[model samples]
Target: MEEFSPRILPLLWRRSVPARRAVGRPPRLSVDIVVTTAIRLADTEGLEAASMARVAAELSVATMSLYTYVPSRPELVDLMVDEVLWARGLTSDGTFRERVLLYAERTFAMYRAHPWLAEVPRARPPVGPGMLAEQEYVLAAVATLGLPVRELNRAAAGITTWVTSAARHEAESALLRRTTGLSSDEWWQQRGELWENWFDVGSHPTMTMIWNAGAFDRGADQQAQDAYEYGLGLLLAGIERSVEGDDRVP
Candidate 1:
C-alpha cells in the first residue's frame, strides 16, 4: 500500500503554491469565490450538490478552473467548514454555564443554518484559524471550572463531542423529515396499529406505564429541546462536582 499524503493542510494554512499567473488576462476566479459558492450550494442543496462541476456551473466557470482555487472536493469541504466557523466566531464571555450554553446553542444554530455541516466528519478537523478560534473559546469557557490542564482538556473535548453529536442528531432528523415529507409524529402515527394491536403491557410494563403517564406526549421539537437542556444541566452539574474534588468524576 502507498503512504497517504495530505494536501488540504497546506491550502488551509495558506502555504499552498499560488496558481500560475496566466500570460494573457488576470484570473477571474478567486479562492474566496470558489469557497463561498460551494458553501452556498451546500447550504441549499446539501454537501453532495456542492461538487466541483456543480459549483463551477454556479460560478459560470470551467470545472477544471476550480482546481486553480481548490485542490479537490475534500479540500473544498475543509475550506467551507473553516469559513463557516470563522464567520460564526464563538464567544467566551458570560458565566460558565451561560457561556457553555451559548456556545452549544450557537453551534446548533450553525448546523440548522447549514445542515451539510453535520455531514462533515471532524475526527481530524481542519487546522485553520477558524478552528483554532473555536478551540480558544472552548478552553476559555472550560477554564472557569479551574481544573488542571489535563482535566480542562478532557472536559473541553467531552463537551464539544456531546454538543456536536446532539446538534448532528437534530440536523439529521430535520433532513429526514424534509426528504420524506413526513413529520416524526406523522410517521409514528402511521405505525399506530402496532401500539393498538401488538403492544403487550406485560412485555413492556415500563413503556406502558410511561405512556399512561403522558411521559411521551410532547411534540418532537419540544422533546428534543428538553432533552438537550436536561443533558446540559447534568453536564454542568458534573463539572461543578468535579471542581469540588468529587471522586466519581474520574
Candidate 2:
C-alpha cells in the first residue's frame, strides 16, 4: 500500500515546487483563481457542494485541470478556510478586553457569513498567511498583560479556543435551522406535547423549577446570543484577574 500525502502544506505556504514547463500555450488558470472560485461556491452552497467538478464547471475548465492547481478536495477546502480567514482579518486597536471582544465578534461574524467554515475539520490548520495573521493579532493582545511567555501563550490559546468553539456552535446551529427549515424553538415547540407527557418534575426537580420560573422563556436565538456573551464576559474577567496576579484564578 502507498502512503497518503496531503500535498497542501507547500501550497498553503506558497512554497510549492514549480511545475514543469508544458509544450503549449500558457495555462489560463492560476491558484488564486481556483481558490477564489471554490470559496465562492462554498459560501453560497455548503462546503460539500464545492466539489472539484463543480468548481471546474464554474471556472469553465476541465475537472482534471483543477487538480493541477489544488491537489484534491481536502486541499481545496483547506485553502478555502484559510482564504476566508484572511479576508476577515483581526484588529488590535482597543483596551485588552475590548480588543479581545472585537476579535471574538469578528470571528463569529465570519462564521455566520460562511457557515460552511464550521464544518471544516481544522485539527491541523492550514499554516497560511491568514492563520498567522490571526494568531499574531491575538498573541499581541494577550502579550499586553505582561505575563511570562508560557502564561502568555496559554492565555492566547484559551481566548482563541473559547471564541472559536462558541462561534462554531453558533454557525452550526444557524446552518441546521437553514437546512431543516425549522428554528430550534420551532423544533422544540413541536415536541412540547412529548415533553408534557414524558417529563417528570420529580425526576428533574431543578429543571422543573427553572421551567416554572420562566427561566427558559427566551427564544433560541436570544438564548444563544446571551449564552455567548455571558461566557465571553467570564473569560475576559478571568484574564483580567490573572493579569492582576489573583491567586484564586487557578
lDDT of 2 by residue, 1-250 (tens): 6344657777786634666678889789988899988888877888888999999999999899889999888788888888888887676677888779888888998998899988887677787878888889888898787666777777888889989988998888888887998988898899899777998888999998988899789988778888888988888778777766554345
Worst 10 residues of 1 by lDDT: 1-10
TM-score of each: 0.89, 0.90
On the 0 to 100 scale, the lDDT of residue 158 in model 1 is: 76
Off-target runs (Cα >4 Å) in candidate 2 are: 1-6, 15-26, 246-248
Clashes of each: 0, 0
- What would the per-residue lDDT of candidate 1 be over residues 1-250, giving only the tens digit for each residue? 6333377666676624666668988778888889889999998888999999999999998899888889888789989998888777677668878888888988898889988887898887788878887788888898987877788877887788888888888888778786798887888889999988998999999998989999799977678878987887898888767888555467
> Residue 144, candidate 1: how far off, in angstroms?
1.9
- Checking candidate 2 for backbone clashes, the offending pairs are none
Inter-residue clash pairs, candidate 1: none
TM-score of 1: 0.89
Candidate 1 wrong stretches, greater than 4 Å: 1-5, 15-26, 245-248
